[model samples]
Target: MRQTIRNVSPMSNEGRNAYVIEHLTDALLTLLRDHSINDVSISELCECAGVGRASFYRNFESKEDIVRLYINHLFCEWADAYEQGDDKPLSALIQSIFAHFERHRDFYGLLNERRLIYLLKDVIIGICGPKPEQSKDDAYAKAFVAYTLYGWVEVWFQRGMKESSEEMAGLFKMQGL
Candidate 1:
């Protein structure tokens, strides 16, 4: 399945904030598949997203902001699903994630190629609302879980996402992490 950001015409009916975020995120992903993020300029991104320079600036401070926001958007969707009672066995969350990644495979592939997946580890963990114990050990444990899950997903995408979601979940179960 091909997943794309909604175009401007349909996005006009969506909120302005959502419109800007979707367009800018999609435009960045589209460009990243062919060009390095450093090689992309605000003008180029604005043009690709079909928004004026002022509009882009009004929404985002820099190109990096777009990447961060895009990652946050994905995590937020997962959080929403969990809130809506999708959470059961952890495998269910893993399955939903695999499905989500499949939908945005191209963008995830570009992020993987650019070595930017690490930047999202904290964001993903934060959105999941892991228990907030303030102990040093607790912090380390959270970091370990975040990095392990994020790293696994990054490697999976880097490897072309060949495994089925159930297969991936089974591998995790075998590890007992």
Candidate 2:
């Protein structure tokens, strides 16, 4: 999900690139608190991150790529935790997803406030949507599940996310969704 310039080779120095990525990510999120992604120039971001423009260009293609990559990184982390957990039921999975969002409420709340929550749809779909190898019915089912999950998250954010993750999972159970 992290989009980098094609010319940036994977053989580049890993440690330095990781440092640059972390700093840029933090800087971009900090700036996003007070400015739209469009309002913050790449120079401003580089200066805030204490990295040069070449580093920025080396790591990311656009400001939005930073957000996309961060969200994906967070989701991958959540996925790892979910995989390690024992309970794998539908309701439990729903609660885990909501809890993951709850754990990062500030970041998510900011996205909601900025009307950028739509960005999350891609993350969800990329993780859960149909794969090419699946049968048509299976693929359709996966797509349905992914979209339905996104719908719940969107409504939850729209409602100011007052309900606890447990309550949201309970609603899913009650509705048999």
Candidate 3:
């Protein structure tokens, strides 16, 4: 049976790529679940994965590398969802992202706050792109949407995912972007 992403298209070759990434993700999650990101070592990761440092490096530069790639790959998936007729804007994407995070909660729960912040910003900018407000240095208006999405999404996660996806979709829709 073909796999689906939130009742969307069946899985593809991209699924194989995601499978590899998920393994790397799983290894990292095991480390974080054991302790925290700070306590984990590259050597330990290699040992746990039973893959050489070279094998790890072949797939990723560092643990964080895989995390970023994972996020980017999800974005590509989100973008593809649009191609598949799910054009609901940032909120739908955010809901899917929440599901993604929930799936890898251990890894992120232990991530360096700075790295998480950067990752969030990277994703926000990737989704929002260069706005006219930013181009014109509109300050609050320029950054409002991204920052709001960034802050509140973190808040949503930290608050134990109290909000439903529809609630989040409402939040994004309220932004009127």
Q: Pick the candidate with the highest TM-score.
A: 2
Candidates 2 and 3 compared: the better one by lDDT is 2
Q: Candidate 1: where are CA atoms >4 Å away?
A: 1-18, 128-140
lDDT of each: 0.75, 0.88, 0.63
Better of 2 and 3 by TM-score: 2
The clash number for model 1 is 0
What TM-score does each of the candidates earn? 0.74, 0.88, 0.65
What TM value does model 3 have?
A: 0.65
Number of clashing residue pairs in every model? 0, 0, 0
**Candidate 2 ranges with C-alpha deviation above 4 Å:** 1-12
Candidate 3, 156: how far from true, in Å? 0.7
Give per-residue CA lDDT, model 3, range 68-138, as digits (tens). Answer: 77677766875675557645555666676666566656544555333453566777665654555464555
Q: Write one digit per residue (lDDT tens) for candidate 1, span 10-50.
A: 44534866777788888988888888888999889888987
Model 2 TM-score relative to the real fold: 0.88
